[model samples]
Target chain A: MFGFVNANPKSLSEEEKAIYQAFYCGLCRELKKRGGQKCEILLNYDSVFLALLLSGLYEPPENSFSFKCAVHPLKNREAYENEFISYAADIDIILSYESLKDRVHDGGALAYKKLLSSLEEIYRSSAGKYEDKAKAAALCVKKTTEAEEEKVSDIDILSSFTGEMLSECFVRKKDEFSEKLFSCGFYLGKYIYLLDAYYDYLSDRKKHRFNPLHLMGFSNMSDMTDFTEPLLTAYISECVNAFEMLPVLTYSGIIRNILYSGVWSRFNIAKKRYLSKEQKK
Target chain B: MDPYKVLGVSRSDSDDDIKRAYRNLSRRYHPDANLNNPNKDAIEEKFKQINIAYDQIMNERKGGAGQSAGRGPGSSYGYRQAGFSDDSAFGGFSDAFRRNNERQQQSDGISPEMQAAVNYIRNGRSSEAMHALLEVPEYERNGTWFYLASVASQGMGNMANAQNFISRAIQLEPNNPTFREFSERLNNIGAGGWYETGRAAYGNPYGNNSSSSWCADLICMNLMCFCCRC
Candidate 1:
């Protein structure tokens, strides 16, 4: 759920684009309102995607209004206001706070400590509201730390930890589509976990950081790509397959574009960057 | 059942249109196609309904009583009823789809070693599966064998070996879409290239080489640039 989820703007129509923007701005505004202006920095496409998915699944009444903001002071951009947006915003704050807290503890980074302190109240409130989700997230962090400490080498096991955490987050709302949503999030989470590991393999190796691919005996990027890319693609295909089965009414096209293509674009970006870096060497 | 509605076509649609619709829908709902799908049972049921619909429509058109006689819901119908017998134009699509499910059950009617390997891969024991595959006689290694070996290699993070095996699979069955797609992806990654080279020439960073996301970046860039210009 880190800012990897994005919609392919090309596949979106003007109205769909507006809807996406409204949701994005809407999440940002919610974050600022709930977690303060500083927390707005944590606004990401992943949260917006979550909001879009939940909204599409729930088919809630549309509630949007045009508003002028600092980024676009001259234009009154549409801002969507809804329960899902606020929920996503709160989840984002909690995640950011937890992530910052982990980084602060690991590296003793004073700046992160200060930021975490600032968001402490908001995090506490969000954690109270979503106790189960907060617990699941904390468990994920704990499991990840354990895996790193033990130097677990199995990519499947390591990625499943993150996948489980995300599955909990996605199925926070128990409904008819809960199972499908869980499966979709589970696979997407796995893809993200593997993609992050694959992307960081070289740097992690150089820094002697804990990378599952290196631990799994992949010596180079090409070898890593060959072994993991197919598995990653399979996860994406499974995610898309699950996504197709969900009975999404609104923004299905846009969501499909993101699932089917937008996520793949991120892979392409990583591939290009890796290729260019290799050529430079 | 209205075969036209089942195939999502109008009654006035030409034979070619009806055939095309049936082909597309059947492929989409095929049990083998939706193997990982949780709704596979429903899809399989829909596929049977589709076959029944197509058979009934074709039979009606041919002035024959259509194989609706004594064929229960769960009964298997031969692929020959699709009017595709001896027709090379369809490239035996119906036969391929029919055999896809059957092949899963029989493991392509190969020896126990091949079936064991397939079962191991299905159960997530890729190393054991690869071992089983290795024991197969070299001459007995066919497309299915190579494809399964490729999958097992991929599971073991041996992408180079996976690519080699999948290439062999593609060579044996060049017309297999699944094998071709797998080979194409393996080659693309092995070459360290994304999508196709033609797409890179068009200044599309994500290149339109693959069917998914083709021209996606170009269209997105143009749209954003146009909006910014305004």
Candidate 2:
């Protein structure tokens, strides 16, 4: 959930965008409700996506209301409250806390460790609610970090760990949908992990750090993408395939837009930048 | 089922339209593309139906201008009539995986672990197959080692890992058509790749040489320099 999942704003209709924003504000409000002002900053589109997906899948009663916030001081924002949003918010805290813990463990500056400890009280409260999910998330982080330290050249093995984490988090219920939900999270997580590596290749090269794509001998951006784009396409296709199996009708228009087009927003922009850089050289 | 109905085309629809529909369906339902799908028996069946429909349509139009011009449907549509049953073209994972290992053992002695891994893969014990493969010393791993690794990973539901391993296999044995074919089938690259499937699924009926995309890319490249001031 490293802030990579997003809906393409340009692709969404005005009404659809507003609907998405309502969920966004609703998630923000939920975060504030849990950990007050400091936790609001952790509000992200990925968590909002989980909330939207679960909401669309299960038509839970929404506690709708108009709320005023500093972001929109003059106008009251249309906000929604539901069990899923609260659930997503709890996951948001647990994941955020774990990622911070990873950075601090990775010999990050003292400030990061301080931040991790600062969020502990909030994290413990949320993590205590879903011990299974939190433990699974932490385990994946540990496995992924260990793989990175070992310089595992097989990126598939490296990314699979992160994918496994999402696979665990996606299954909130045990039912017919669990298998497909598990698959959806796995592929989505792979796409996110690999795309993150794709964007960081240049800096990773500069620092002489490990990058899976670079290790594959694709020194140039075009070569790297030529190697990567098909993999990403296959992954996103599988993710959408699993998503289609879920019986989700309401808010599906917006959710489909995000899954289909929005998720590619960052990849497209990064491609243009990297390709243009190649041209400049 | 009527060939036209299967292809979602009609006699009134031009031969081009029918062929295009056939091309899209074939790629979408290709056995190589859906190696990871658990319900693969159905896909292979659907692929057969698509092929039969396409051949039926093509045979009906055998004397058309395309046939008269010596351009076979095989080349233009990227369909291989032989590929339908050929081990090299659409051998799914197990056959493809086994064929390559047999070829490797022909010239020299294959490590016992490599042979064991192949048997394990054939028997649907990919986890043990992977462990057996790990027993092979790193120095002795040829393209076949990487190739089998990819197949084992495929069986274990580690698709992305499978793709990269096969790609490495191809890098090690670039000219080995079997390795190249395995890489293409695993990663969905080269001819009948994922991008082609994408173009076929989306509205681009003409293929990658469409004037619209060519012009768009040209303009984007030109404008990138002018606008960014890098």
Candidate 3:
């Protein structure tokens, strides 16, 4: 669902890179187990992190299975069996479905449009299984699409909508720890929206498309990095704070490094790179 | 909750130790550091608790000393009380966004150019302020330029010139407390105002007795120009 991860090559240390790959593979295994091979492509780091978090939080029923992916032919793969991973898989389907629907409505190109259309049945079935998450994701995407169409200026409203949807996913099994997880999701949702809005700004401008920052009349994206950096800093801090709440599962170390060092620094450096590229152009 | 214990201090710890403890704890549980930690809810709750504990202990100690001195007594303690139910301070300050129409209304029918000048002043963009101020209509140029000049002069550390420009600001905004404060602060640093301690205006507040009337005359001359226009 988060296309930005692939587009931006945020460098990571060897250890972090290995953890990320393992998580990515782990997510692939999860999607396949939950919804079959068709859902494997729906796997991404965003959902992987969510899976890892849920695993850490709930201690999933068991950590079981091994396999190999086309991406890593010779390597052994591990799949975790748990409620959180299952939930993450469901969410991935819901988000991907809604995002696809948005793209179709927004006039996405042929292959992408077709792929999303083909996945609808599977998405609908998964949505049926996880009704609340599906509903929330659908509602958030709908609101975001509507705001884009209407050209709304309060970017936080749409960002919060996305945040609330993710937050809702965690809030269902409410407890002291989940509440912290919800808060983390809330700010991270805002961070994601800001970054996506920023990365898409120039292209959106060229295509006569809507960007949240553009709606606010911020001419330069870096100008927003100052405003956005604090949110990112807060996002990382929340992740750190959430760490204490985590029950310390199998992949806790992997998740922590990805969150604290990888995602944090990537977001921190992205604006600088984006600005310099804009300057060069 | 023992406030001293909350701050990791003994009851006999010096004021400096207490301050240091508060600073260290504040940095550790600061909302910025733990943005999305799964335990953010607990951290925030703990943070609020720590803040309250520290404040209570510090205030009790300060109050005890102040009571002994009997100086500035009976005044309301402005320090934020922890027992208060309001969490707005803990949530962080909100910058209220006034809608464009409301912003225009607040500018008193000022042209967009003049409004931009004022915004530049508030944002510390003096060059931009000058650029925008120049765009004001000729009829309104005097007031706009003077206000912009006051902000620019103040930013540039030319207090005398700043006072001159501020007097012009007073002519335009007689009842504006902010402008009055600016004028008052400038006057205090020069001839003498409330900020001057143990010296009357006539006694040469700058400590050079002969300098009094000269500085006072400069202020009087500036105010006269402003009064003449008013």
- Clash counts for all predictions: 1, 1, 13
Q: Return the TM-scores of chain A for each candidate in numbered order.
A: 0.94, 0.96, 0.83
Candidate 3 per-residue lDDT, tens place, A41-136, comes to 566557777777776555546656677655446767555566676777778888888887888778886656766766878788888988877888
Tell me which residue pairs clash in candidate 2: A8-A262
Residue A259, candidate 2: how far off, in angstroms? Answer: 2.7
The CAPRI class of candidate 3 is: incorrect
After superposition, the stretches of candidate 1 with alpha carbons farther than 4 Å from their true spots are B1-230
lDDT of 2 by residue, B73-149 (tens): 11112223321122222344456655665777687668899888877665555677889999998989888889889
Give the total clashing residue pairs for model 1: 1
Candidate 1 residue B80 Cα shift, in angstroms, is 35
Two-chain DockQ for each candidate model: 0.05, 0.06, 0.02
True-vs-predicted CA distance for residue A102, candidate 1, Å: 2.3
Query: Model 2: per-residue lDDT, tens digit, A65-127?
Result: 898776557878788899999999999988888888886776777766665676899999998
The DockQ for candidate 1, computed on C-alphas, is 0.05
TM-score of 1: 0.60
| Comparison by TM-score, 1 against 3, better one | 1
Q: After superposition, how far is residue A230 of candidate 1 from its true place, in Å?
A: 1.8
Give residue A238's lDDT in candidate 3 (0 to 100): 34
Residues A1-281 of candidate 1 have per-residue lDDT tens digits of 46667766665678887888889889988987886556666777778888999888666777889887765567677889989888888788777777677777677556566667878898999999999878878888889889889987766567766777677777757643465576667777778888887767667778777887776665555666667766676565546544544546477777876776666656676677776777788
How well does each candidate superpose onto the true structure, as a TM-score?
Answer: 0.60, 0.66, 0.53
